[model samples]
Target: MTNDFSPLSQWQLDRARRTVHRGGVIAYPTEGVWGLGCDPWNPDAVEEILELKQRPAHKGLILVAASTDQIEFLLAPLDPEMRERATRHWPGPVTCLLPDPEDRVPFLVKGDHSAIAVRVSDHPVVKALCEAAGQPLVSTSCNPAGRPPARHGWQVRRYFGQGQVHIVPGALGGNRKPSRILDIVTGQWLR
Candidate 1:
């Protein structure tokens, strides 16, 4: 698949955004694996992804963004030191669990926890998709629970099928493992 954000890439990004806006799930490349994304605010879409993965709602999900600005609403309540510590590892492979004081994030995305897992991605396709979507997306590995994450386009298709998800054409970032998960408040690693 294409790497750079060319015109065709932009077109695909636009289409992906449209699909997410319409409450559709999409599969795209992320730092280490293929990720399934949809509007985090849409309960139906989030439920669809959960059902597709055979994952329970209490496990929660990660929200991927193009930049910290896109998720400032979720980060604004944290202490400056905590915020800095969390964001410092961003634009890369690190997902930080930030506290949501006002309940801005829906329960379906945050699951049974009070904190929301989020990441600012450096992958071009992920960044482009988040930018086009105009918000953080519900990003989780594109594979059913108890299975390995998809590292190839074919694997993504095989896991989700052709019409089940809108596959955004791209290549995975050069990372062997998925993003490390950290809880900023306690400074503990979750993954």
Candidate 2:
């Protein structure tokens, strides 16, 4: 999908990319709401997000990427049909749980599960941020477990305060709800 939306300044994108590379957490707009993202391979960064949201480690987190190629290492093992099933709903508000047989993903990112949740986002800001970081990022709702996900920049600020997370400037995508999550391996709708 084409991403003509460019709501963020180059400086903002660069700062976010730097923060991710430095193992800091950042809040950026996503398909339905603001999202907290960090380098998925950085365990400390992932822990910071979990702590900020008061989320349990076992729940795992989703990885968002600019394109399927960014996550090709994980998807390459799946059969052609299973891979197609997951890719068909991507570049949009859909997350698919795919088996991580080779354990390419970190334990913190996958939690206790054998499968990891991932999405290829069409949101320009998300795509840009992922591209800037040159890897998939750990994505979770900006709010704490019980709080509503942040839909506005101010909401993100209110939830985590200014210095807690580096806020990447942008507006949420048109989706009114969070991404639909599906377990492609089991053919189950998880959300």
Candidate 3:
């Protein structure tokens, strides 16, 4: 019998990619922490992540992509210099802000800012998930507000417990530092 809850497969991964076509929340690995992600288009799913983490919606979230192209809808409108300026930092930990392409973006994801933070990841699994999912996800550190970020699957399980998440199996990437947060406009590191 196929266990309903075995680790993910290429098929399930493909399914996840397709399912996210409509927008939903998911968890995946990041450089130094596991991250919670969702379809930026789905306000309900984004809201679910906020509720799950007890995160204040106004704090905003990051978006992760398989490639700069995955978020083309959000990036295409940027002036060439602005687009080039932002693309220079990607396929790595540096997240940058770009204009929101659609009104579907919730105020929570934009936080108090005028632009949304996004990145194209270098991590293999994150690349695969976004590649398979075929869209950038609303990426944020996986933890309750005021708690430590989860660095391993077990830590993620311990923090959220089994019922809330469909934990994808993987080893954490060997990065000592979490992704650096910067104001793309000011070049200031917020974290």
lDDT of 2 by residue, 96-170 (tens): 999999999998889999999999998999999999999999999999989999989999888998799998887
Clash count in backbone of candidate 2: 0
lDDT of 2 at 184: 94
Which portions of model 3 miss their true places by more than 4 Å?
A: 1-8, 18-24, 101-104, 186-191
lDDT of predicted model 1: 0.90
lDDT ranking, best first: 2, 1, 3
lDDT of 3 by residue, 1-191 (tens): 11122345787687567656655556677776888877776888788889989988888888889998897877788778777777787878878777675644568778876778888888776777787766778888889988988887887888887757655555566677877666655555677
Clashing pairs in model 1, backbone N/Cα/C closer than 3 A: none
Query: Model 2, 120: alpha-carbon shift in Å?
Result: 0.4
Give the range where candidate 2 is weakest over 10 consecutive residues by summed lDDT. Answer: 1-10
Would you estimate the TM-scores of all the predictions? 0.95, 0.95, 0.84
**C-alpha lDDT of residue 133 in model 1:** 91
Residue 135 CA displacement from its true place in model 2, Å: 0.5
lDDT of 3 at 92: 81
lDDT of each: 0.90, 0.92, 0.75
**Residue 115 local lDDT, model 2:** 96
